[model samples]
Target: MNRKIIFTENAPGAIGYYSQAIASNGLVYTAGQIPLDPQTGEIVSSDFSEQVKQTLNNIESVLVASGTDLSKSIKLTVFITNLSNYPELNAVFKKQFDGIDPPARSVVEVSALPKDVSIEIDCIAAL
Candidate 1:
């Protein structure tokens, strides 16, 4: 099975030893994307909804880099610092996913995330 490492300046540069996403075997696996803006390299907004939007945008960039799109996403894993933000997160998610059939998702509350961000998201997408 041939594999390709995906990278793009449209998403936050990986701070660790990992590619932004990998495309192979008819699938693209994306790294967890936070709310950081790629240009500014800073968390775009502290608000949950805004953060969610930024994260999703980052995810879109990775998908595009891997020659895929959101429609190809098969599953999403969302990790949040607080479950209370679910409503706000859901609202942002709905704005994007509601219009189209989004991939299956699982959301969990974690004690912390990299860079102290409130949310992080990763996904598996078909290419």
Candidate 2:
């Protein structure tokens, strides 16, 4: 089986040793994306919703690089620093995942995340 590493300048580059996404079998799995801006190389915002929006956009870029997109995503994992932001996060997801069945998802509240960002998201998408 052939596996392809996915990368794009539209999203923030990986800070460590990992591809932004990988295509294998029939799916594209993405690394967790935070709110870092590709252009400035900094977290976009401190607000929870803003961070989520940026993270989603970053993940979208990775998916596009893999020749797929969030609309075709099969599963998602959201790591958040605060569960209190869950309702707002759902609103953002509803906006982004609009017109689609919405993928299977697991949201976890973690004590901390890289760069002290509020959220990080990753997904598996179908090609």
| Model 2: CA > 4 A from native | none
Candidate 2 residue-wise lDDT, 1-127, digit = tens: 9799998999999988998998999999999999999999999988889999999999999999899889999999999999999999999999998888999999999999999999999999999
The residue pairs in collision within model 1 are: none
Best by TM-score: 2
lDDT of 1 by residue, 4-116 (tens): 99999999999789989988899999999999999989989888888999999999999998988988789999999999988998788888887689789999999999999
Local accuracy by lDDT, each model: 0.92, 0.94
Roughly what TM-score does model 1 have, to 2 decimal places?
A: 0.97
The TM-scores, one per candidate, come to 0.97, 0.97
The alpha-carbon deviation from the true structure for residue 105 of candidate 2, after best TM-score superposition, in angstroms, is: 0.4
**C-alpha root-mean-square deviation, each candidate:** 0.8, 0.7
